[model samples]
Target: MKPAVGAIRRASIYAVVSYGGLVLINNSGLQLPSMWIAYLPMFIGVYVFTQWVDRKF
Candidate 1:
């Protein structure tokens, strides 16, 4: 149960950081060719980072 809670918290933090970064980029006037172009890499990056953190820790 505790591990589950910790996993959820960690994932939530990653999600918030990714979302905030996207928001910042959108506000900075740089535009991607498509929304999927922007989102897909970000999603993959977050997933990779999370896996790395879990493994390293």
Candidate 2:
């Protein structure tokens, strides 16, 4: 239950960062497709990686 709760929290943070990254990229003149293809995945991947690291440590 505790690990589940922590996962939910980390996922929420990832959502925020992913959305924020998309917004920033779009505003910076990147096309929607490109933004999703590039920046969004990186942000999500990093977030997941960090969560894995957290659990490991």
Candidate 3:
């Protein structure tokens, strides 16, 4: 149960952070036809952040 909850929490964090990235990109006047491309950075960012958090917490 704890592991499931932790996974959910991590996924939620990634979703929020990725959305923020998408908004930032759009606001910056760089409109991507395939917005999924923009998610690359967010995915990497979230992966690194989660890894660090897991190690530290």
Q: What is the C-alpha lDDT of each candidate?
A: 0.76, 0.70, 0.75
Best by lDDT: 1
Task: Give one digit per residue, the lDDT tens place, for model 3 in 1-57.
Answer: 999988887777767776777688778776778766776777788778776675565
Clashes of each: 0, 0, 0
Residue pairs clashing, model 2: none
Point out where model 3 deviates above 4 Å.
Answer: 31-38, 54-57
Task: Note the residue pairs that clash in candidate 1.
Answer: none
What is residue 41's positional error in candidate 3, in angstroms?
A: 2.8
Model 3: per-residue Cα lDDT at residue 3: 95
Ranked candidates (TM-score, high to low): 3, 1, 2
Candidate 2 Cα outliers beyond 4 Å, as residue runs:
31-37, 44-57
Order of candidate numbers by lDDT, starting with the best? 1, 3, 2
